[model samples]
Target: WKIEIFFRNLKQNLHIKSFLGTSQNAVEIQIWTALITILLLQYLKRIAKHPWCLSNLTASLRLNTFTKIDLFQWINEPFSPPPDEPEIA
Candidate 1:
């Protein structure tokens, strides 16, 4: 069924092998978070100029999470260096 495919995608992309909490509310929250994450990633992929596969894009994001670069620019041109800042007066 389509739902099985959806869960498979979540597990493969998000590495969500097990739920973090046993309570129903906690499980729902975790699933919702993962769903939101997938939607956001799909949006980024659609908007990016570069032809990025989903897994690669996800990995690149994880690798660059702390880097100080413009998000749009980085997504469009991941290999390019960040733009230089003007010197402070």
Candidate 2:
């Protein structure tokens, strides 16, 4: 079923094995966060020029999150050189 596959993707791709909180509100927030993350990644996958598997895309983003660069260009050409930084006056 589609729902089963969705949950499997969450577990495997998102690495959400156990809940961090026992309260209903906390659980809801965690699930919502994961859902939003999936949505964003899916959007990236669609827009990216280079063919990207979801897991690899996720890993790449995770590794590059802190690096300063043009996100749109990176999505299309990840291996290309980063954009130049403006010189501080």
Candidate maximizing lDDT:
1
> Candidate 2: misplaced stretches above 4 Å?
86-89
TM-score of 2: 0.86
List, residue by residue over 1-89, the lDDT tens digit for candidate 2. 99889789999898889889999999899889999999999999999998999999998998998988778789899888776788999
Q: Which 10 residues in a row give candidate 2 its minimum summed lDDT?
A: 77-86
The residue pairs found clashing in candidate 1 are none
Report the C-alpha displacement of residue 44, candidate 1, in angstroms.
Answer: 0.2
| Each model's lDDT | 0.92, 0.90
In order of appearance, the predictions have TM-scores of: 0.90, 0.86
Can you list the residue pairs that collide in candidate 2? none
Which sections of candidate 1 miss by over 4 Å?
A: 85-89
